[model samples]
Target chain A: MTVTLAIDCMGGDHGPSVTIPAALHFLRADRKARIILVGRTEAIEPHLGTALAEFGERLRVHRASEVVGMDEPPAQAMRSKKDSSMRVAVDLVKSGDAQAAVSAGNTGALMAISRFVLKTLPGIDRPAICSTLPTLRGQTHVLDLGANVDCSPEHLLQFAIMGAMLVAAVEHNERPSVGLLNIGEEEIKGNETVKQAGELLRKSGLNFYGNVEGNDIYKGTVDVVVCDGFVGNVALKTSEGLAQMLATFLREQFSRNWMTKLAAIFAMSALKGFKHKVDSRRYNGASLLGLRGVVVKSHGSADAFAFEQAIWRAAEAARNRLIERITERMERERSAA
Target chain B: MTVTLAIDCMGGDHGPSVTIPAALHFLRADRKARIILVGRTEAIEPHLGTALAEFGERLRVHRASEVVGMDEPPAQAMRSKKDSSMRVAVDLVKSGDAQAAVSAGNTGALMAISRFVLKTLPGIDRPAICSTLPTLRGQTHVLDLGANVDCSPEHLLQFAIMGAMLVAAVEHNERPSVGLLNIGEEEIKGNETVKQAGELLRKSGLNFYGNVEGNDIYKGTVDVVVCDGFVGNVALKTSEGLAQMLATFLREQFSRNWMTKLAAIFAMSALKGFKHKVDSRRYNGASLLGLRGVVVKSHGSADAFAFEQAIWRAAEAARNRLIERITERMERERSAA
Candidate 1:
C-alpha cells in the first residue's frame, strides 16, 4: 500500500528551508510514498526548485494562507487559524488527500488542531503523544508526553492500549509488553490515580509488566511505558536536561586545552560513534496516537535530516495502518468488557 | 553551637564499612561537630578502631541491637524494629540528645520512623524530602523527592515555606526564589493541583518565580523547585537513568579497540574533571524538611566519600539550627494567616 504524508511546510523554526528538503529526501528514498506540501505557495515554491517537475503529482503543493506562530496559544490557534499550514496538513489527512500528517509546529497547537480536525478513534477517550526514547535494548515507547495533564485511570489504560498498539504496528511486535510508569516497582507505590491505573492495567490483557520506575524507560524493561501527561512530560524534559548537561560537560572537557584538543582528535571517531548512538535526531518524531488519522509531531527546531526522519516515521505508521490497529484493539477491549 | 548528629550506622548497603569511615572523615573535618554512632556494638567496633580514642568523648557509640534491612517494609520496620539503628538514631534527635539524625537506610522506613519520633512542626501538614541537584549555576533544591505523593495546595505552600527555611538555614540564602514544577511555565499549565499550588505560591509572599518546567531545575532558573513527591521522584530517577546511559556509552566508545583505548588514556584527565563536576556523590544528602528535628537521608548505596558528604550536610543543617528556622517560619506564617 502506498503511504502519503501531508507536510506542514510553513511550520517550525526553519519552516520551508528544512521541511522542503526533508520531504524531497523522503520522496527520493521511498518510491511508493507521496507528500502534499501544505503552506503558502511563494514560500514553498522557492525551495521546491526542480522537485515539482521531478516527482510530478507525487510531490504536490497545497496552498495554506496562515502560519501558526511557535508560541501561539492552543485555543487561539484553533479558533483563529483555520487555514494554517498545520491545520491544512491535518485537513489533508482528514479529507483522505493524505494518509498521515507530519508537522514540526507548536506541539500544543498541533495537538489541539489534530484533535479538533480528526477527532479520536471509537472507545478512545483521549489522544496521547507517544514517542520512542533510546534505551539499552534499543528503544521503548512512552505515551501522554504532554497532551493530558490530568489523566483518569481509564485514560491511563487507554494510553497503554494505544502505546502497545503503536509499538506493534510500527515495530511489528505481536505482543508488546506494557509497563505503567510509577515511582516504585511495587504495586502500592505512587498516588491514588496511578495505583488505580495499575490495577486496571493488571486485568487489561495487554501483556502488562506490572509497575516500572522512570529508569526502566531507559533500561528498556518494557516496550511501552504509560503515565499521565504531567509525569510523562516531566520525565521526558528531565531526560532532555540531563542529556544537555552531559553533552555540554563533555564538549567543555574535550576543548579545554591544547592537550585535550589533541586527545579529542584521537578520540574523535569513538566520540562520534557514541554521539550517533544517542542522537535525539534519530528519534525525532512523536506519534499523536488515538486520533482517527495518523499525525506525527516533529521537534520544532529539527534540522532537515531530523525532519526527514519524522516524515519517514509518519510514512511507516501510515503504511502499517496504526490507526486501524488502535481502533481494532480498543474495540476488542470494549467487547471483552 | 556544637552540632551533634545521631548516625544510623547499621543501615545502607555497606553498613558500618561505609558509615563508620565516613563518620570518622566527617569528624576530622569539623572540629565543632560530634557524631553519636547508633548501631550493633560488634559491627560498629570493628570499624571504629582508634577513632574512639582519637576523637575522645566527642565521638560516642550508642549501641542498638537490631538493624533495619534495606528492603524492609516501612510499617513492618516501624512496628517490630523499635531497637533498630534507624529508630535509635531518630530517637536521639527526638530526645534532644542530638540536634539531627543521618540515615542511609530504607527511605520509606526512615521517613516513617523520623515522622513518628520527631513529628511534623506546628503549621506544617507533612514533612518533605528536599535535596540539591547539580545545575548550570551550582545547584537548586527540589522537594518533596518521595515523601508526600498527593499534596494539596496548602501542603505545597507548607513545603515551599519549609524548603525555603532549609535553604536559608543551610545555604544561607534568605528569601530564596521558589518555582512550582509544572509542564509549562505558563499560568494555564499543569493539573488543578499544580495550578492551585501555583496560585498559593504566588500570593504566599515567598520569593515566587511563578511556574518552572523540568529543564528549569537544571538551568538553575530558580533557587528552589517545588513539586509533589511522585513527580519529583520520577524526574530524579529519570535523570539517573539518562546519566547512566551516557556514562556507559562513553565507556563503551572509549574501550572499543586498542586505538580508542590509547585515546582514552590521553583523555583520562579531561574525562575525570567532567565526571567530578557532575558526581552524584557531591549532592548526596536529601534533607527531610518540616520535621521537628532535622533528618538527612543518604543514598542507600553511597560510598564512603558520598556518605561523608551526607554527614557534612547534616552537620551544616544542625549547626545552622535548621529545625528552629523551620519552626519559627511556620509559626510566623500561622500568626499572619
Candidate 2:
C-alpha cells in the first residue's frame, strides 16, 4: 500500500533541523511512502537539500506561515495559529492529500487541532492519546494519556475499543487483549466509573482481559490497557519521572570514585546495550486514536532518528488502514446495538 | 516521652519469622521505645527466644488467637477476625496501651481495622496513606496512596493538611510545601475536583506550591504531593512496574555473554551502590494519617530489616506526636472557618 504522511516540519524543540532530516530518513527507509513537508518554505527548504532531487515527486513542501509554541494553551493555539505547521499537517490529512499526519508539537495543542480538523469517528465520543511503553514481555499500548481529564464510563469503553483496533492495525494482532487499568485485578476494585466500565467491556465483544493493575502495563499482561485520561496521563508521566531518576542515579554511581569510574569503562558495552533496550527514543510515537484520520504525536524533545520513528509509525498506521478498521468496528457495534 | 508500638506478629507473608525479628531489632535501636508483639503465643514465642530476656520489660508479647490471611477481604477480616493479631495490634493503640501500631499485613485490612478501632480525628472525614519516596533533592511525602479512591475537593484538602503534618512530624520540617498532583501545572488544567482542590489548597494556609505533574513527585518540587488515592496508587504502582522492567533489562544485558559477564564483575560495586540508593525497602513504611492513633503499614513482603524500618517510622511518628499535630491543625482550621 502507498502511504502519504504530512509532516509538521516546524514543530518540536529542534524544528526544521530535526523534522526535515527525519522526513528524509523516513522517505529513504520506506519505499512506498510519500511526505508533504508543512512549514515555512525558507526554513524547511534549507534542510531538504538534495533529497528533493533524488526522490522527485515522492517528497514536497506545503508552506505554512505560523508555528505553535511548545507551551501554548490548546484553545489559544486552535483559535490563533490557523496557519501553523501542525494545523496545516492535519489539514493535509483532512484535505485527502495525505493519509496520515505527524507532529512533535505541544501535545494539548496537537490534540485540539487534530480533533478540530479531523473530528472523531462516528461512534467515538472523544479521541484518546494512545502510546506504547517498553515491557519485559515486549510492549503494551495504553490510551487516554492526557486528552480528556474527566471521562464517562462510555468514554472508557470507547477508548478500549479504539485502543484494541490500533493494536490490531499496527501490531497485526487480530484479537489483542484489552485490560481495564485499575488498582487491583479483582472485580470489586476501583471507583464507580471503572467498575461500570469493566461491566461494559466484559460485554463489548472484544478480547477482554478483565481488570489489570499499573504493573501489568510493563509486565505486558495485556496488549491494550484502557483508562481515563487523568489516570493514564499520571501513570505515563510517573514512569517518565522514575526512569529519569533511576538513570541519573546509575550515572552518579558509575562516576562516584576511581574504582567505579573504571568499572563504568569496562561495563560500557553492556551499559550501552542495556540503554538501547530501554531507550525512550524507540517508543517515540503516540497514536491519537479515535480520530477520523491517523495522527501520531512525537516527543517534543525527540532527535532526528526518534522523529523518523514517529513518521514510520504514522506510515504503518496509514498503510494498515487503522482509521477504516476503527470505523468499521464502530459501525458494526452500532448496527448490533 | 516513652513511645510504645504494637506490632502485628502474625501478619505478612513470613509472619513471626519476619515481624518478631523486626520488633526485636526496633526495641534494641530505640532506647525510649517499647513494643507489644500481638499474635498467637505459640507462633510468636519461638522468634522471641532471648530478645525478651535481653530487653526486659521493654519488649513483651500480647497473645491473639486468630490470624488475618494475606488475601482476606477487608470487610470480612474486620467483621469476623475480631481476635486476629492485626486487630489486636490496633486495639492496643486504641486502648492507649501503645502510642502507635505497625503491621506488615493486608493494606485494606489494616486500614479498615485501624479506622474502625481508633476512628478518624475530628474534622477529618477519612484517613490517608502517606509514604516517603526517594527524590532528587531528598524525599517527598505523597498521599493518599491507596486509601480513598474517590476523593472530593474537601477530602483532598484534608489530605494536604494531613500529609503536611506527617512531614512536619517525621521530617521535622515545620513548614513543608504541598503540591496538588495534576496532569498539568497550569491553573486551568485537570478535572473539576483537582481544580477545586487547588483553590482550596491555596487558601489552606499551608505552604501550597500550586499544581505539579507526575514527574514533580521525583523532582522534589515540593515536600508533599497530595492527590486522590486512585491517581496516587496508579502512579506508585506504575513506577514500580517501570523500575522492575528496567532492572530486568539491565540484568539481561549484563549476562548476555562472557565479555558482558566480565563487565558485570567490574561494575558490581557501582551497581550495588546504585541499588542501595533506590532500594524500595529503605522507603518501606507508609503512615496512615488522620487517625486518632498513629498507624504505619509495612510492605507485606518485607524482610527483617525492611519491616524494622516500618517500626522505626511508627516510633518516630509517635515520638513526634503526628496524630496530635494533625488534630491541632484540623482544630485550627475548623475554628478559623
Candidate 3:
C-alpha cells in the first residue's frame, strides 16, 4: 500500500527550499510512500530538478494558485486563501488522493484549514496538537500542545483517548498509559477539569496512571500525558526555552577560560552524546492529532533535515492508519464524553 | 529597627528538623534579623540546642496549639486549624510582631490562610505566587505560579502591575519590564484573556515588553512574566522536571565509560560551576505576592539550606516593604482594571 503525503510546498520561512528537499528525501528513503508537491510550479520546480527523474511516478507536483502568509490569521486565511498551497494540500487528503497532509506553515491557518477540510472525528470535541518530547527514559507523547486553548473535562478525556491511540499505533506500546498533567500527583490536586478528568480516566478501560505532574513529561513515566491546550502549550514552550538557555550556558561555560575550552575539546564526544539526548530538531514533527485525516505539522523554521523528519512522521502516521485507530478507540471508549 | 520573621517551624516535610536549623542558619548569617518560632515549643526546642545561646534574645519560640497536615484540604485547614503553626505564624505578621512569615507548609493551605489573614493588597483582586528563575541575564520573576487558576483579562493586567512592583521592590530593579506569557509573541496569538491582557498591558504605564513565549522566561527578556496560575504553575513545574532530567542525564553521561569518567574528572570545576549556576536551592523561595503583608513560601520538601534561603527572602521582602510598593503601584496605575 502506498502512503501518499500532500506537501504544502510554499509555506513557512524557507518555503520550497526546505520542503522540496524534504519531500525528495522522504520519498527516497521510503519505497512505499508517494508525495504530491502542492505549490506554485515555478517556485517548487527550481528545487525539484533531478528529483522528478530520480523518483519517477512516486513524486509529482500540483499547482496552487495562491499562497498563505506565515503570519495570516487562521479564520481569515481559511476564508480568503481557498486555493493556497496549505489549503490545496489539505484538500488532497480530503479527496483521498493522499493519505496525509504535511505543512510547515502558519500553525493556526493549517489547523483551521485542516479542521474545515477534514472535519473532526466523531466523539471528538477539539483536535489537539500532539508532539513528542525527549525524556530520561526515552520519549513522551504530550497532547493539546496548543490547538485548543480552553478545554472541558470531556475534551481532556477525548485527548487522553486519542493520545493513547496515537501512542499505541505509532509507538506500538500495547498498553500505553496516560497521565493527567497536574501540579501534583494526588487525586485531589489540579483545577476542575483536571479533577473531573481524573475521575473519568479512572473509570476508563485504558491504562490510566492516576495523575502526573509537569516533571513527568521529561521523566517519561507514561506514554501519553494529557492536559488542556493552554497548560500544554506553556509547558512545551517553557521546556524549549529552558533547553535553549542551558545550551547557551554550556557554550559560555566551555569558553570561559583557556583551561575550560581545552576541557570542552577533550569532552567533545560526551557533550555530543548529551546534545543528541536533548536535540530540538529530533522532536520537530508535531501531529495535528484528532483530525479526520492524518496531518503532521513541521516547525515553521525547520530546515531541510527537520522538514524531512516531519515528512517521515507523516508517512508513519499514514502507514499506521492513525486516524482510524483514534476513531476506533474513541468509538470504543469515551463515547459518553 | 530589627526586621522580625515568624517561622512555621512545624510546617514542612521534616518539620522543625528542617525549619529550626534553617532559622538558626539564617540568624547566624544576619545578626540584625529576629525570629519568632511559631510552633509547639517542645517540637522546636530539641533542634534549637546550642545555637539558642549564640542568638540569645533574637531567637525565641512562640506556642501554637494546632498543626495542619500537609495533605489536608485547603478550605478545611483554613477553617479547622486556626491555631496551627502556619496560622499563628501568619498572625504574627498581621499583628505586627513580625514583618514577614515563612512556611514550607502545604501550598494550598498557605495561600488560603495567607489570603484570609493578610488579605489582598488594595486594587489587587488575587494574590499570586512569584518566584525567581535563573536566566542568562540573571533571574526572572514569574507570577501566579499556583494561585488563581481562573483569571480574567483585568486580573492579568492586575498581575502584571503587581508583578512589576514586586520586581521593583525586591530586586531593586527600577523600571522593570513585564512580559505577558503567551503561546507566541504575536499580538494576534493566544486566547481571549491573553489577547485582552496584551491590549491592556500595552496601555499599562509599567514597562511592557509585549507578549513573551515560554522561552522568554529563561531568556530574561523581561524582569517579570505574568500569566494565569494554571499556565504559570505548569511552566514552573515543567522547568523543574527538565532541570532534574538534565542533571540526571549529565550524571549518567559522566559515568557511562571510563574515558568519559576521566573527561569528567578533568572538567570537575567547570561542571560544579555550571551546577551552582542552575542550583535549585538558589531559587528556592517563592513570594506569595499581592498580600497585605509579606509571605514567603518554601518548597515543601526543602532542606535546611533551601528553607534558610526562604527565610532570607522573606526578610528581604519585609525590609523592602513590598506590600506598600505594590499597593502604591497598583493604586497609581491599574486601578481601572
Candidate 2: C-alpha lDDT: 0.93
- Per-residue alpha-carbon lDDT of candidate 3 for residues B186-253, written as tens digits (9 for 90 to 100): 89778899999999889878899999988889988999999988888889889988999998888888
Against the hidden reference, what TM-scores do the models get? 0.99, 0.99, 0.94
- Candidate with top lDDT is 2
In the range B51-95, model 1's lDDT, one tens digit per residue, is 989999889999899988999999999999999999999999989
The candidate 2 chain A region of ten consecutive residues with least summed lDDT is A328-337
- Runs of candidate 2 with Cα error greater than 4 angstroms are none
Using TM-score as the measure, name the better of candidate 1 and candidate 3: 1
Candidate 3 chain B weakest ten by summed lDDT: B328-337
**lDDT to native, each model:** 0.92, 0.93, 0.89
Native contacts recovered, each model: 0.75, 0.81, 0.69
Candidate 3 runs further than 4 Å off: A203-205, A334-337, B79-83, B199-204, B333-337
DockQ of each candidate, alpha-carbon based: 0.83, 0.87, 0.70
Candidate 1: list runs displaced more than 4 Å. Answer: none
Please tell me which predicted candidate would have the highest DockQ against the true structure.
2
Report clashes for each candidate as comma-separated counts: 0, 0, 0
Clash pairs detected, candidate 3:
none
Q: Order the candidates by DockQ, highest first — what do you get?
A: 2, 1, 3
